[model samples]
Target: MPFQNTMGDYQTRQTLETFGFLPALTQEEIFDQIAYVIAQGWTPSIEHIHPSQAMNHYWPMWKLPFFGSVDLQQVVNELEACHRAYPDHHVRFTGYDNYTQSQGSAFVVFEGRR
Candidate 1:
């Protein structure tokens, strides 16, 4: 993937990228990773799309996403709810810091398995 600035435009970055995923990461692992992202002062947001109609552009999962919240548990709960709600669509959680126009991390907990 190319670098994306906060403006939803592509740009290069001097910083190293941080990201990871697994089909088998445990719930505790997810919480730990999210907690680390929250500790970085980044706000988490979710995005999902249908596997059949995948778009090149990113689509937000929430209309009004929580910004700069320090509540990791609540964020995790919201992720769980999203996973439950869209069990058949690809879903991802991404932490963004709007000020820097940079995303701290992104995780895909569900792959829309049938």
Candidate 2:
């Protein structure tokens, strides 16, 4: 029998979260995504977690979901505030759809030190 490479040896490192595997989104792009979420009537929320524990635990919500919020700038402000407070933590933005009662969209907005 000839020696052959098998799939079992492959290993992947845990990444930040959704959108983490892809190139970081630009500020404008992030804004656009938030806008879309709001347009869909999804409430926006921010969460943060230390990079080391990102995959092991649930991130704590920054404050609370911005219910009834249509101001894009307000959401951005909260995101910025969370980043400032947790400079070494990964910050994520999520949209909660009331009708579905689940997260409709989510993405990492700021990446912490790995």
Candidate 3:
């Protein structure tokens, strides 16, 4: 017996790995999310990688996670700095939960030009 294909030639659209399905987030929304993460006592971190490699490779951290950081402006400043330094790379923000030893929240803040 031979196997039969159920669907034929269906093409899928490739999108960004994070927050791709929804509308893009504004600066204010991003700030709010960051503040929430901090209030929850989660450490925040930024990571970036070339858009082309976003799906296959792990992004490198922009700097050490802002552990015990209470200043929201400082985290925003770092995020801006990372965007300035790597304008052509996809930038992502993450909140690390110490209790779960895993990421509690994450989303792409910037999408690189294709």
User: What's model 2's lDDT at 27?
Assistant: 91
| Model 2 agreement with the true structure over 78-109: per-residue lDDT tens digits | 99999999999988999999999988999989
lDDT of each: 0.67, 0.85, 0.83
Error of 1 at 30 (Å): 0.8
Q: lDDT per residue, candidate 1, 1-114, as tens digits?
A: 333545333233222123421134577887887888788877788877665644445665743567878898888788778878878776777888777977778766666653
Q: Would you list the rank order by lDDT, best first?
A: 2, 3, 1
Best by lDDT: 2
**How big is the positional error of residue 36 in model 3, measured in Å on the Cα after superposition?**
0.7
Q: Estimate TM-scores for all models.
A: 0.71, 0.85, 0.84
Worst 10 residues of 3 by lDDT: 1-10
Off by over 4 Å in 1: 1-23
TM-score winner, 1 or 2: 2
Model 1 earns a TM-score of 0.71
Considering only N, C-alpha and C atoms within 3 Å, which residue pairs clash in candidate 1?
none
- Residue-wise lDDT of candidate 3 within 23-102, one digit each (tens)? 67779999999999999999999999887888865789998999999999999999989999999988899999999998
C-alpha lDDT of candidate 3 relative to the true structure: 0.83
Worst 10 residues of 2 by lDDT: 1-10
